[model samples]
Target: MERKVCAAAVQFNIELGEVEANLQKALAGIRRVREKDARLVVLPEMWSSGYAYKRLAALAEETPRVLEILKGLTAEKNMVTVGSLPEKVDGRIYNTAFVVDNGRIAGRYRKLHLFSTMGEDRFLAAGDAALVVSTSVGRLGVAICYDLRFPELFRKLALEGAEILCVPAEWPKPRQEHWRTLLRARAIENQLFVAAANCCGIQGKLDFFGMSLLISPRGEILAEGGETETELSALFNFEEMTSYRSQIRCYQDRRPEIYGTLP
Candidate 1:
């Protein structure tokens, strides 16, 4: 990994069941960030189609094609990117985030925790494993919307040599504080970088508050977006993370033997 790398997140309005429109928007956002020399980019969850439950199966069918497009773009720009799309596999639908690094599919993280409050578990099959993969940029840990609430998962990723965390979400209003606090807490506790993308605007009955963020190991907000369609970019310095970790000695002082290991 380079000592420093540029990362970005894209936020936009996801129209329900409008695969083509949403795809074009995502592409535009990716290009915009790439132009600014961002070697890694993250997009919002279910970006190709909002929570159009009635057309979810059909929408999921487009994920492969969309991924191909992303692969080509990443290769052309020499970038690594991640975003969530509805995936249909073996007749089961899952909210899956695909990590594309330089034209290859680096890894996939199916959302493990479905938001039962919104009936997500009823429609989508949950993922059983977490993802921490090596990419063109660096080692990355991936998580979806609801997965952010689970600190254990993030801790596992950090312990497993993940240097940066990428989150793709479609979080709605009335809980913006939770999003901000949890993201910072995850970075601070794990002593790594975090880049999260969230959609903005209204889709169906839900309104999304776009506050995509890029945070440092010290819980500093390097870059952030507002409640609108936009892109936020920041440079992540691995040396800074190493310095902070050495100074804090959090990992060195861990008592996993007494507290039990994380799965």
Candidate 2:
């Protein structure tokens, strides 16, 4: 049986190298989203670090600390939350994101495609496995930051029964068009709801594109934010994704059997 769920996307700014302040800001957004009766809240990538990609050594938190805190938020609000954070695991550093559901971690996905143009590969390690988790809302697929540019990732997730794709990003201003176009393509082609939460304002020298968007299966932007902080909430009907997929049969038309080494 399918359930009806409301999703909230929190678009906000963060303090560079200040986890305490960012968490306070993010916590306020969480409370606000809960007040609005949303069952899930989405936050931007590396939000706790203000997309301060340079300060991983100083601002990065232990993975356990992140999970311990988000557990309380999920339990108290009775909802799920997702966002990316810089991780320190077993002495290795990774740019990663977590999906918290029902008071515990549903799963975590690492940012596989590091943007070398931004020198991300210089500081962080790329992740190997794709994360797909089954939730009460639906099967959720997670991709952080640069992962949005890769359509094949969404295709694989769609093939795995993912009805909703959560993208937590720190996309800067210059590439706003790419962000919007790629996000919509992912939603329309995959026949899934795309909830993309991006940071607003400037983080160090880079300015973010604040068009945090929640889109429908038909590739329409149901809600979009401007160049400021906002918690954009919208209701999505999973039935639409299901109905479109059944009618169009996009998945069935795939010729994966003859294809090899798809990105």
Compare the candidates by lDDT and give the number of the best one. Answer: 1
Steric overlap count per candidate: 0, 0
Q: What CA RMSD would you report for each candidate?
A: 1.3, 1.6
lDDT of each model, Cα atoms only?
0.94, 0.84
Q: Candidate 1 has what TM-score?
A: 0.98
Model 2 RMSD in angstroms: 1.6
Q: What stretches of model 1 exceed 4 Å from their correct place?
A: 261-263
lDDT of 2 by residue, 1-263 (tens): 65567888899887787887788888888889889888777899887876465668666654467668889988877888889888877766787888898888888888899999988888888999888888756788888878987888888888787878999988987899999999999999888898889988877788987899999889999899898988888888877777777999877888877897855
Find the 10 residues in a row with the least total lDDT in model 2. 57-66
Q: Tell me the tens digit of each residue's lDDT in model 1 across 1-263.
A: 44889999999999899999999999999999989999999999989998898789999999999999999999999999999999999999999999999999999999999999999998999999999999878899999988999999999899999999999999999999999999999999999999999999998789999999999999999999999999989999999999999999999999888997545
Which pairs of residues collide in candidate 1?
none
Off by over 4 Å in 2: none
